[model samples]
Target: MNPGKRYLFAGLTVLLAGCTQPAADSPPSGIEAVYTDFFKEADTDRSGTLEAGEIGASIDRDFAGLDLTHDGVVTIDDIYSKEQAEPPGSTRNPDLSSHLPYDTDSDGRLTAAEHRAHLLKLIGEMDIDGDGLISFTEYRVTRRF
Candidate 1:
């Protein structure tokens, strides 16, 4: 092989190899790591992809937490109530940004169906491949609140 052609081929090979993704067994970093943790928690069946049921189950638990009043629906008052109950200088105050928009019915209340809609929207965004499955990488690009 000619010297120049050999060098070009070597460079191309290295570039293509670099483009390959890291092994799934490899530990993740930064946002990918965070999403990895969430994916593991949400992938209850260990199917590798997050399905609607898994997401629903997880979101349902979260919805229960948000509904502090136990009235079966979440309202702005409930959110603010939690925020006001926080200790002074508490950075862990409730963030309404994560809740208000989920009220799809716009009746000033958030229900389980509404909450599921928002999460399903997230999953739609995460399904970049349009395979009806959300992978950890796709989930990494999307996060509520």
Candidate 2:
């Protein structure tokens, strides 16, 4: 082989080898992957932490939809009513099961405070080191499985 051709082939081989290696920050499969992917998409500011405002729009929309009586609050009744009204397996219906866990006061309703607390708790879990920030490494290590 010509000297120039040999050098070009070697360069190409090196590039291919580098491409095959996994990224240092690549998230693993399962739960970690889900959180990592969500964090990446939700961190609109790219500040690494998913702040309240970053998710405020989604939260507001969901809350509004679930607060059937326009009482500025969501109760189990509202969820139950919505569930009953919707046909089985309807995609339009929101899964109310997740909200049940956030009823810390046990008043049978989910207030804004409870909603905020639930979100904060999730953020705390993701920030395993309690550094008030969730880096990719923290997210990876915090996976339950």
Candidate 3:
């Protein structure tokens, strides 16, 4: 992917994850707090952790918005097709990405498990403090590796 597309895809991925991070100087919030907030929305069973079934249930509702062709799966081609159909000079940022969002298996097809795993991967990377917690700065500067 080109730099522009890569940047766009990264932003879309973050938006889709639905994370909330305060500024670097703001009061820190525990990873559990953020995780709870995130999982609460996706964990339909209130099981404290998200399951593939719950993730799929949520995705099923959202998939309709992305599956423009109603193929039951979204691909990069589908994204580009939507891009072309948009009006010229359109400033709209699509929720889809060519980086193959949430495709943990890298089959180029997104599954609910893949989506959940991707979020877990990102959460794993957020605890930069190494103190069993994430500082506000760590969450704000999530790119720290």
lDDT digits (tens) for residues 22-65 of candidate 1: 99798978876776787899899998888878877888887898
| Candidate 1 segments exceeding 4 Å error | 1-34, 84-99, 143-145
List the global CA lDDT of all models.
Answer: 0.78, 0.69, 0.60
lDDT of 2 by residue, 40-144 (tens): 776778887655676665456556777888887787668777765756676542434464778776767788777767766766787676766667666656655
lDDT of 3: 0.60
Cα deviation at 58, candidate 3, in Å, is 10
Alpha-carbon TM-score of each model against the true structure = 0.61, 0.50, 0.36
Quickly count the clashes in candidate 2: 0
The residue pairs found clashing in candidate 3 are none
Q: At residue 40, what lDDT does model 2 achieve?
A: 77
> What lDDT does candidate 3 reach at residue 20?
60
Clashing residue pairs found in predicted model 2: none
